[model samples]
Target: MMKIYLALALWMIIAEHELMSGAELICKRRINAEYRASVLMSPGYPFAYPNNMRCEWVIQAPEGQQVEIIFLEILTESCCDTIELRDGNTSSAGLLARYRGNVSESIYVSTFGSLYIKFTTDDSFVFNGFMAQFRTATTKTQNCTVKLDASDEPQLLTSPGWPYGYENNLLCTWTITAPEGRVVSITFVEFETESCCDYVLVRHGKSMRSSMYELGGLLKRPFTDVSTGPIIQVIFRSDSSLSTSGFKIQYKAVKRTKTDLMEIPKKDKCTGKIEIPEAGHGTLTTPGYPEKHENNMNCVWVLVAPPGMRVSLWFTSINTEACCDFIKIRDGETPTSKKLGILSGHSTKFAHYKSSGNVMRVDFQSDVTKVYSGFRAVYEVLNDSSEEKCGGDLRAAINRRQYISSPNWPNNARSLYCAWNITADEGYSVLFKIIGFHTFRRRDSIQFFDGESAIPFASLRRNTQHDDESFYSQSSNMYVIFRPDVTTVQGGFRGYFVAVPKRQRNTTPSILVSNLLGQHGRDNR
Candidate 1:
């Protein structure tokens, strides 16, 4: 006859140490308090183990549902990881749980009655709080946008290509610094009048991957990074047109050293500009190499409209709404930018004489030398404004001392798409562009696999949460949720990648990261 053990404990782990370091409560919750405790685990009392290592405990359950325990005294540690249930099993040998001990790890036990669960660890620095709470079973939560004219964290800083103007597929540059181990991802959401198109996402300077609608593209591979976050270059594009008034990349994490954040690269600085030939259309700043702004709404630049120079300012605007959006153009150093004219049309494209667009003919009218410029617009954003969609913002970042590694320069601009339909804790199919990679260093047993070179989310392995086959259908570049704010790149994600490359562009800007700005940030220069 075989003997079975049941583990029951109000408290599983009890570590009463005098010289305890690298120990943490992490987070804990009573079951039913919040359904999010674990997308995979059921709502119940948060189960935790207390010993320094070798978790040992038991739980008493009602006679009928003993098989609900997914894990028992699950022990987690940093550095290396492994999985060992009460049945003396491992991630290998086709077990359900494996531990690489690299990123993170946990142990689980399954049974309905009283079960004995124990776990141990080698790293003395880690001690996670495995919570076991009691709550009713619920569905998973889907991430949604929070429409805002006001936000907890305001824009603080921005570039010229916002509000009413975007270059279809354009490249832009930004700089930032961050501490080690932090995550940084950009956000571009908007409430358009349903007339605008969907936008694309990119990581300029690093990888150029458009939206992922399907799974089998060469651009869906997973990339790694070693640099501190507040990563420099991140790109975004408009899938459809939209009249964006606000944008932001909510704060996340940064993992690097302090030294690296302090001594970052110094690219083009926002300065006064000089007049140059065919600089740009529609009143662009010259003299100042990198555009500079003192306040959130103020910037300085030099514009030229010489006598008989045959030059006209060009721009696109929102025409669906009854009222008009204003772009002010001014000359001189009055502490502001000027709007040469208004793009009062409904369409987003503009041309000179031979087309159906708005253009300000430079029949040699405006002054030449007194070439200073400023731009501004104040108007209500209509509910269904058939203008632009999607908005983005500048979040936080950190830097490190040691430089991150990488593969080749300008990783091939891979384009892809995805289509997913998921419910609750079940989510899968990750479409990403690779920038760098490293070796595994933990004991893990989660069912996962890799795709072809560029098409990462294409293929996968069979394992626990991932084995359900539903994940493969619910993943796409535009809809990635978990770790939504984190990205890895060669030489660290902080190294930077250009958002918009010159080859494929119209208005969707690019991201260029050369060096560190001031104190790990550029305030959108």
Candidate 2:
């Protein structure tokens, strides 16, 4: 009886092995029309799959029919074990989708007669593998594709499975048609999707070739666009991983006239040229700044600094309709110059932009739609010669030295606000040493920042004196600022900087002096 029991146990083990091996073999084959509907699974499926695996399968439908795959269950090591779906019968076919990790129920359809699937695993952790089924389906049977016709009333469109989050591995197309002599216009009400893998594409005509715009990510405000012709196509695609709440849009057909196509002049409240005074600083604001700006605005402000100086601009407050309103900055006097940046959205954090020459142009444009509190920016002129100025953009090189000092340093420096931005190449750090420093202990201050951050990492105030102090930056950039109260003035500060290899940085204060002396000695010799 014991021998019989042992034999039964051995047979059971053999049966389990056979099942596992059979599943592996089944995963690496080609299915034909003989099997109109079938299942594909990872080896040892419903259990943790083995590590280090590369399996492939091809599901082929009859001619004129496409293949559709439905994933009923999916679980794998996130990002390490992956499944790739292709549109043809071979590995080199156009990739349809790729998936990893614990994916929810999803579906994929092929554009042709065959669908190829590949599963790969790295030599690490494992998890319960996936189970999917494939079947043949015609294009008309697809539920996600739809067509709409023009009407006096607008039509509202939404992503499939809206609000509940869309399924993965989806390619949904929506085509809108207008009557003869009319065009289509679409206004997005809400748009949010998996930014990296899900997007909505807009095209001008019935075919997919005349591309108009592709939009993704979370939309902060409403967006509107008009089609050029009587037909428009919108396509939304999501890959085989994450999903989001999707989008909602209202589309309508409109008759176009000559007046609608022509550009009309907009009345703006603020548009002019700003000249920096001798103090080398000035401020600019949008129309009704600190409050909602007026719509249909087309404002321009050209800032001119004194000759031989550059313009450094910083925004203290910014809020606007993120979609249709903008503040565009150019690096020179006219719109044809290189664009520095386009500011939109809402942000209270301070950011800095500098021009290459003495002129910077700012243009503000708002569509006829929404409005929000506008922006306020301050501009300062930076002297080009370091010997005659207290602040400028400084670059440090290996084994080389650079110096910065207060305006008319070694003399009593008065009311001033100056800044110096020091940077070094990657894999290196900046070493700053104070050769001479003296400031009012109560009112005057000097700040040191590790990067472009608004907060300073170190500071000196309250009658501080550091004749031979050193500071090391954590990264490749450092920012220094000096601000003195108007009441009293003292001998300001002087500092020299050098770039040091991050791997061999010396933090000792005395080494800075020795290094500087050694460089000076080399220069003298």
Candidate 3:
């Protein structure tokens, strides 16, 4: 079969550090495929060793379908000669990825870092899922990251008590390995389930019926099983510290017949737009109402304020899920004019699970104010992680905190370093990039928008593909940053980074650059 490559970048806007330390936004993107192949991060050009990268691919054939997974020789087999696929200390296998530097031995991280596999049509395979997290390049090295516990024999079985939403565990005649002398202390750390207030168990070299432990353990830690029942597992870790080191697990009934696990049928795919109101009825004026996406994205009702009145746009998604998707709202010119609100992946990054309207108030003076209009927020949705990210409902906790900065610049950077204008306890945030941005190179002062005017803090990302089709070549690389609080700041506050993506080379000829004006005011505010 011919190979078609698919590259997806989960672009998110990050606010300044108002949150935690050592926390970097881990952007994760997943795709379900039937087979596995070599998937690693390449740093564009050459680098010392490889671009210290990690990739995960689902390989085992799902139950019901006998299938075979295939990998493109062009990408994987070529480098197979020099690359390592599994952990170093352990007997190697070309089927899995190798664990090199930065991989902690205490956790399955070394094995989880990067993985590759090949499937055959004769072997059953089903869906393929991918994960992309805006995680720190640094690995987690702690004695308590992954916990495991077991007697001797281990077995693979399903138990509703498995932590991290899983209902299965491996109890069997499994083997355990650790980093050097850490093995004895690295038994089964602990297993806690998101479902209940208790812990579950899995025995080694046994079956589901035998892998049992009581709920509620005094100490919880990371763990791993070597081999249990039919499923052979060398490494297993939870989303949030399930198991780290080498834990065995036998294969489950998730296997399928090679023939049944065919390509995803197009008929079952997601179709046209979902009929939902952009803004749930949180609060609205007689003139200003929620934006709905029914008619060709037709946004009705312009700047209609009864004499002297201030409009409060309360979003219902403020506490619900409508906020996970994307929508648009505009005023003054056409609905297509400068977008008043264009939510980015930041919405999902925010620890706020409240679905609908997080408020955006605007005071229009006699309807003559430039942005004399309101907006309907378009949302960004979720795949793997849920609304309870970094921390949930951050806005509702703190309100009205703003901070600015003075930062480092002289480098070949696109954005300036501005100190974050944030308050310790306030529902506030640092603005990264505003939508409706007008990049002017001709003049020093750039207009934030081309038309009448737009609102502030209204989320936006450059449509480089459509904006400066010539200058902004890498629309994929360019993204915005948004920090709700210093606590939400994952790693150390590295300050806001402005990136201008470079395009691939010109094979023949592309679009021409138009003379554009310059905008002097940067977000270094």
TM-scores, all models, native as reference: 0.17, 0.36, 0.19
Q: What is the lDDT of candidate 2?
A: 0.74
Candidate 3, poorest ten consecutive residues by summed lDDT? 403-412
Better of 1 and 3 by lDDT: 1
Name the regions of candidate 2 deviating beyond 4 angstroms.
1-141, 153-167, 185-196, 207-211, 214-228, 244-273, 277-282, 286-288, 291-302, 305-375, 379-525
Query: What lDDT would each prediction earn against the true structure?
Result: 0.25, 0.74, 0.24
Candidate 1 lDDT by residue in tens digits, 1-525: 122222222123222231122233221211212223333221111432333344333443333322123332333432222333331122111122233222222222222133333344443334443433221222111222111122224232232344455433222223333334453433333312112222222221221121111011122233222223334342222222243432333332334455433232222333344342432222332223123211112223333333334322322122321121212333332322222333322333321111112112111111111222222111110111122111122111122111111222112111111122111221322322212112111111111122222332222211111111122212111222111111222111101111111222232212211111211354342
Q: What is the Cα-based lDDT of residue 201 in candidate 1?
A: 23
Using TM-score as the yardstick, the better of models 2 and 3 is 2
Task: Report the number of clashing residue pairs per model.
Answer: 161, 2, 162
Top candidate, metric lDDT:
2
The TM-score of predicted model 3 comes to: 0.19
Candidate 2, residue 331: lDDT: 91
